[model samples]
Target: MTDLIPALRHLLTLAWQCDPRRLLRAAAMVAAGCLATPLIALCLKGLTTETLAGRGGSAVLLGLAAAALLVLELMMGHFAHLAYFELGDLGEVELQNRLVALAHGRPGLEDLDTPRFADTLALVRDDLPRTRASLEAALQLGGLAIQLGLTAVLLGLLDPWLLLLPLLGAVPVLAGNRAQRLLDTAKESAAPHQRLGRHLLDVATGHATAKEARLAGAAPFLLARHHREWQAGTRLLGRAHTRAAALRAGGQLCFALGYAAAIWLVVRQAQHGVSPLGDVILVITLAAQLSLQVGTAIQLLTVLQDAGRTAHRLDALKPLTPFHANKSDATSAPLVLTRGIRLEHVSFQYPGSTRRVLDDVTLDIPAGTALAVVGENGAGKSTLVKLLCGLYRPTGGRILVDGVDLAAADPADWQHRIATLFQDFARLELRLRDNTGIGDLDRIDDDAALSAALDAAEAAPVAAAVPGGLDGLIGRSYGDGVDLSGGQWQKLGLARALLRRDPLLLVLDEPASALDAAAEQTLFERFARLVADSRARTGAVSVLVSHRFSTVRMADLILVLEHGRLVQAGGHRELLDAGGLYAELYRLQARVYA
Candidate 1:
């Protein structure tokens, strides 16, 4: 109930902000509808009394009033529904916008990967589509409360003892709250399993995985796994719902007993000439309305409780503030790096893990140089690249760009001056132009810029051959779109990375994993030349991570990593002369080519 009031207020404020006139109209109609119910019952009682006294004119007038009240009760709700339905939709859009802003406004990537934050975000997303229904339920619940109170008052005026019926209805409201809590707990417990089930289903049916699934003949296995997860989630929820239904049923049964006792008391009073037929009629009508109102209120309260939980989840996520929130230094990133990037005893490990991915290591790269990082799988090459890109802060020590602490600089400003192309790059299902232009949104429509970037990535011919050239859609998901091979898509990703103008730091991690050996060699040669040119112009430092020794040799300097430590560092010829991890790995790869 404490959470309920705040949640209701939050939703009402959103609704009013969305459309104030509609909100006012809806409220007026709801109030009128609530008042009409008790008035209809009063009119019914008056009509019955007048007819019994043989007052024909007064009875006719009372009958007409009862008819009008009945119409008002029925039609006012419809009018309110009409007024608020669009308001509810607008409220939904407003809520979604807020959630999106919250998810994106944070400057650091920590909150995105944190497990508790992820779970809370998922819950909010799941509840987002229910915003409209929740608003309507809240409004309906208010109207029901008003109607229930008025019915109780009318009964009290007739006989004070009948007021106990409304008090009895409170039992169901309390039961409903308990039932909702149980259901909420069960739903939360089931969410992970449900998500897993959906993921398995997507893998089995997705376009990307279809060929693999067919060759492996794993359809039956995937289907069985999905079924297991689905059933596990449903079973937990089913038990909770059954228990909740029983609890609610017991409360309603108690109400039914009270209702029967109240009817008997009224009948006994009339039999002893202590009550009139008109009063008995009024009591029965109000009691029936009270029963319906209680049940509706219980149902509406359940919806409101679910929405309350969503609101609370959002509040819980408030502390996952932006990483640089309270930092005194809000320095802008350097326009040019004269001293290049320097890592001083930098170290890092993922959240909730004790095993360091990168140990205490130090290195320096001069400006206008191409530096290559080579290592075996799990050697922390990618983790090092992430640190250099300012995606993750070093756990120990610090990184400096142009002698200024990278940690103190604004993340957005740093990111704006850097560009990266990772192996698992995003395949945006958009046009060829958008695919490349997304790298520099400010110049997305600049034809000369797009053409130059495509040429730099050796993708110009591929784009020109397509039906619509730069405007051609790239994914089969769109009708009439052209589907590219794996290598072609990688070229587009490379083009996108090149589209970012004059970046001070350019990091490429296995950028040509999908291309052939000849194509890979050609791509690296072009990148080496581009890095040299970009460095001379903007003093950019380019970092390369590749398994191909042939490509690694193109860098001005190479750093060899073994188990997260820089075991060897020197030029290609220098490394071969100094026999170590790098020398041994180079020979093994040379044998494969030989």
Candidate 2:
């Protein structure tokens, strides 16, 4: 209960962020309702007594007051619901948008892969709505507190001893607090169940895992595991609910006993002529009503306590810092990489890992020239491309784009001037035009530009096959959709990279991996033609990462990496003549296809 206060405060903060005015208005309505509760209760007692005393006109007047109180309660409840819904909706939207922005601005992909960060993401995605609902519950609890306070004041006025009857209801409040603790313990125990549930959901819905599950015939096994997790969660919840019911029953028994005691006191006082019958009746009636309100307040507080715990988890997201930007006015205007893009004494290790993926890697690619990066698996080839693309800042040293330090450059602005095709590129489940056009949204509606990119990537056949040409849906999951083969998908990805009309630097990582030798040659030929055309127009730079030595040998320069260090840097023929790591790997691959 004590821990819950901070959580409640945090939820209030989020609510305030949504719309402070709405919250205030809702609170004001609840306060008015609370102020009216005693009046309504007293009016009922007075109307009953007046009717019994043959004062029909006074009874009629009191009846009208009761009717007005009922109308006010309804209005207050309506406004409260409206405010809560609006606040919850706004908070959920803000939280989701902030999370997406944070994910995009994360310095590296590795940062997003950590378990703790993933857990935080899951909490935000799945638990944020629940937490917001809990906040609404907390607000309702506040209204209940107001009602309880008014009831206490009215009962106290009737008889000082009757006030003790409301205090006796605290036993039930304590019982509810105990039940809430048990519920919290149950939720803690179900954490593993929740984790398993999430894993099952991933396996069931993920595209990549479906093929493996079908081949292994493991759907039944996975389904059984999912069921087991659900059962475990339900079992914990059931046990907690049983305990809550037992505690509530005990509380109700205590409350009943307290009411009986108050009734007996009122009767004894009336018999002793210490109080008039009318006053005794009024006191007894008020005590019963107050007891009911006290019970309701206890229940609401328990709910608020549980909500507070959930709210605390959501509060952790409040301090998520926005992406940092360079203060200096750095224009993203096109600049010639005359001395080439250079990495000087650069090193990088992913967070939580001791092994450095790139170590003191110094290299250069001349402006308007092509460079190919080739290495064996785990040889840090891809990490180099990431560093060059500014996806990851160096752990040590710096990357210079035509002598301008990339670290001091605006990341968002700099990224705009580069086009990238990652090894694990996304296959957008959108229209063909959108898939390519997202690379350059400004020209998304330009049919000529879209057609040019498709032609440059040798993806004209794919575009022709689509029902609506560029406008046709790309994935089978959607209506009127068609899925492409792996090689065709690669072509589409290349088309996307080509769609970036103003890209000064283009990075291609295993872009031709899915293509056959003939297709690869044709694609590379078209790519060369496009680059030659672009060079004639703008002198754009291209960087390729590939395992195919034959494909890379055509590059102006080749880089060989071994165990996170640059081992060879020269033209492909020059490296072969030098008989270094590049030559050894090239010969080894040539032997396989000999």
Report, for every candidate in turn, its global Cα lDDT versus the true structure.
0.87, 0.78
Instruction: Please write out the lDDT profile of model 1 over residues 19-98, one tens digit for every residue.
Output: 98888888888889888988888988898899999999999999999889889978999999887888888988888888
lDDT of 2 by residue, 330-435 (tens): 5453554455677899999986788889999877666778888999999999898888877888988898887788877777777777888888988897999999
Evaluate residue 12 in candidate 1 and report its C-alpha lDDT on the 0 to 100 scale: 89
Clashes of 2: 0
Native-to-model Cα distance after best TM-score fit, residue 467 in candidate 1, in Å: 5.0
Compute each candidate's TM-score over C-alphas.
0.93, 0.81
Worst 10 residues of 2 by lDDT: 317-326
Give the winner by lDDT.
1
What are the per-model C-alpha RMSD values against the true structure?
2.3, 4.4
